[model samples]
Target: MEHQTIKRIAAFSDGGQGGNPAGVLIAETLPGEAEMQRIAAEVGYSETAFLAPHEDGWRVRYFAPEIEVPFCGHATIAAGAALAEQFGGGRYRLYLNNGDISVEGEIQQSLAAASLQSPPTRSEPVPEALLAEALALFGWHESDLDTRLPPAMAYGGASHLILPVRHRATLKAMQYDQAQGKALMEAHGITTFCLVHAESPTRFHARNPFAIGGVYEDPATGAAAAALGGYLRDRQWPHHGEVEIIQGEDMGARSLLRIQISDQPGGSIRVSGTARTIS
Candidate 1:
């Protein structure tokens, strides 16, 4: 295994305050899965993205400390920023294990910002049993749930369980044992548990439990944000075609994410945020 340079960047940052860290590696030829996984574990970020030049775009793969996920939005955003830094600002095609996506990078107010066009988005009602299990994991009951958003499994590039809490305090009090969370999430085949509170039809706050990937929580989750946007679109919620998300406040890494939804059914959603290189 040859040495691979890892670029560390914070995705979805808020004026350089808070964001999720991701490792980005751009190579002429990608290493094997085992080596990539090893590097991701060594980097110890929630996710790391490996990129290699393809015919028209780039071959991309995402790896957590423990496993390889089909897609990761925050990592993709970081990758876009890295591409911009290295190759100049432009849109880059990304080929993932599950599907293809695109990301655009540019300099915004002298900061690196990127937007990702997600894969086709969809959602389905969470089974009663699974919902109950999730609630138990969070130590919450049905009364804590927000009646408007309800509970469902949503997907943009990957899958997440979306649970809408009724109050902001409920969202802030989110806590869970990492081992137990990992078990529950793996059993349900979910990557992250998205706990959200709606400030308005177009504004939201979120907390994501990502124990399945050996992470306790994600400061900013672009994938989950895209999933939430898709769910809102699917429900015909009055989003006016766009939504804003504030996440990781409780973690002291207040990150920001913006999502734009298409009118077509199961259409792709766009998630955008600013990223900065870690010192």
Candidate 2:
């Protein structure tokens, strides 16, 4: 039997630490869904990206250990880095389940950095009841929220609920029952709950609870960061053109992400971060 290799890459890492691990398999052709699921289960990361040549670029699918997801940001970053290593750094088009996206990868010094153009983003108000449930799940009250940013459901590559907290300490102490959070997220059609603390107009800290995908938390969530950028753009926040996010600090991973939004409404947001291989 021929030996197969799956590259393990940490996306959005802070140098060598604080990034989310993703399995990247670049194949001549994609395997069947069952086989891909099996591979994803074996890899056991928050998500694995399966890439194969397609119409104009590559067809990509993301899977968690338990289920397939419509889109994933960090895995895309890892895939970009993997592609760069194999084919030399440049821009590549990715055909996802919903739409086409692009990632540009390059080696800067020792770190592999990639920036992805996310799908068009939009946001809507989160229902009061759902907001209350989320607050209860995190043991947070409305008073704990940052009044500047209201709770809302935002979508870039995927859907996420954005809740801005008042203090970094509150964001750091995020805790919830995995099973209960899974149920809530699935029931509410939310992929992740983005809990954030705004450090400044251009700086923020975030924690993502991704129970819908059977993960307790995500160290770095590029999709959520893009969604947040769109949300801020939609609200006309003083983003000043870009926002920087620090994640996984509470969990000691300390990942980093940057978001740049276009002035156009419902435009694709750019999410950029550095990736490194995990030995």
Candidate 3:
């Protein structure tokens, strides 16, 4: 039997040390669902995006090491960079199973920078029981949480629980059991728990426990970053208008993500970062 092949790329990093890695599989036609899942597991990244030619542009599907996801932002960025490298810097439209989205890539000063527009976003208040469980899992007390941000389940492309902590130290010391956390996330239908600490009006720090993706943590999460921007917009958080997210510091893999938001309500937000080839 011929095994399907896929390419791997790291997204949202300057030199590939601090970005979320994803597998980009481009094939004449997508294999069976089981085969895709098997390949994703073998690749062992947070998520793998598979692309196939379609009528409009490309039909895309994202699969984590464990399961298929509705959408994935970091992988989308990687896919965009991959496309730009192969075809030239330009915009690409993607049709996901859930909705339509777009990504753009360009060469800026000899570096590859890509941006992705997330799907429509929405948020819901976090339940008391769920909050308590999450705090226990991370060994954080209620006092550690930021009262201003208020915990909520936010979704742009995928669902994530956004919990703002009061202290940067609390955000830095993130830990959880893989099995237990995965069970909790699956039970709650969440992709990851986004733990954050605000550094300034426009800058923030983030840590994501992507247990559902069969990974202990994500170095950088574009989908969660987009969701975070939408959440802040909904609450009208004070900022310089642009949000900067710094992630993966605790893991020794530092990454940076920039989000641009508009004044319009429910407007699509842009997430941008630089990507370098891993090979």
Candidate 4:
């Protein structure tokens, strides 16, 4: 049996204390799908990222405890940090199962700073039936939704249901039955439910229920965040070209993610954050 070493790193850390943890494996070649799946389950984190050198950059893949995801923001950030530590600071291209992206990383003040250019984004209005089912799962009323950002099926790299609440309290009170939510998400091809509140034009709070990936919640989700940025762009929300997201505070992880949005519709969003070793 062949085994590859994995590094545990947390991305989007708040002052080196809290962030979403991910496992990063970099080797000459990626492991077989079954082996990678087994490793991800054994690691038991929200996600694990694997990397191997490709034509001009690296091939990347992300896996959760139970299944694979199209793209994972935190895991990519962790991988970028790991690559920076090993090969020095620079921008690197990443080839994924469905797309290509780039990551820029550097070590600054003993922390890894990385930015990932997300896949192009698009959003669609949420179906009424799906919206109703989601509301029931979270015990929220339609009135609780923020009219500023209507619910949508948003996709940056992977798909997510973006539900913006009118109040921060509603966002904080998010809860759902894991099994039921998982079934609903899988049935609808949703990666997670990105429940959020707009604190201001430039600041937002988010909670992600990642039932499809077999996690109850994600402290920080870059893909969802990017999707939100793009969705806001589509809705003509006054984002002012940039936004900051504070997530996972309720779970004590306190992750922070910064995003830069472009004007072009379906443009790529740049998601950046600091990372540190879990250690």
Alpha-carbon shift of residue 259 in model 4 (angstroms): 0.6
lDDT of each residue in 1-279, candidate 1, tens digit only: 444578999999997778999999999999899999999999999999999999899999999999999889899999999999989999999999977999999876546999999999999999999999899989999999999888999988889999999999999989888999999888888989989999999999999999999999999999999888999999899999889999999999999999998888999899999998888
Superposed by TM-score, candidate 1 places the C-alpha of residue 184 at a distance from the truth, in angstroms, of 1.3
Task: Give the clash count for model 3.
Answer: 0
What's the TM-score of every candidate structure?
A: 0.98, 0.97, 0.95, 0.98
Write candidate 3's Cα lDDT for 1-279 as tens digits.
143456667788855467888888877788789988998898899999999888877899999988999988889998998888777899999999987999998765545789999898777799999999998899888899898899999998889999999999888777889899999999999998999999887999999999988999999999999889888888889865799999988998788899997766776779999877666
Better of 1 and 3 by lDDT: 1
lDDT of 4: 0.94
Each model's lDDT comes to 0.93, 0.92, 0.87, 0.94
Tens-digit per-residue lDDT, 132-223, candidate 4: 99999999998999987899999999999999999998887788999999999989999989999999999999999998898999999999
How far is 85's C-alpha from truth in model 1 (Å)? 0.6
Q: Score candidate 4 by TM-score against the native.
A: 0.98
In model 1, how large is the Cα lDDT of residue 267?
A: 90
TM-score of 2: 0.97
Model 3 clash pairs? none
Least accurate stretch of 10 residues (summed lDDT) in model 2? Answer: 1-10
Off by over 4 Å in 4: 1-4
Best by TM-score: 4
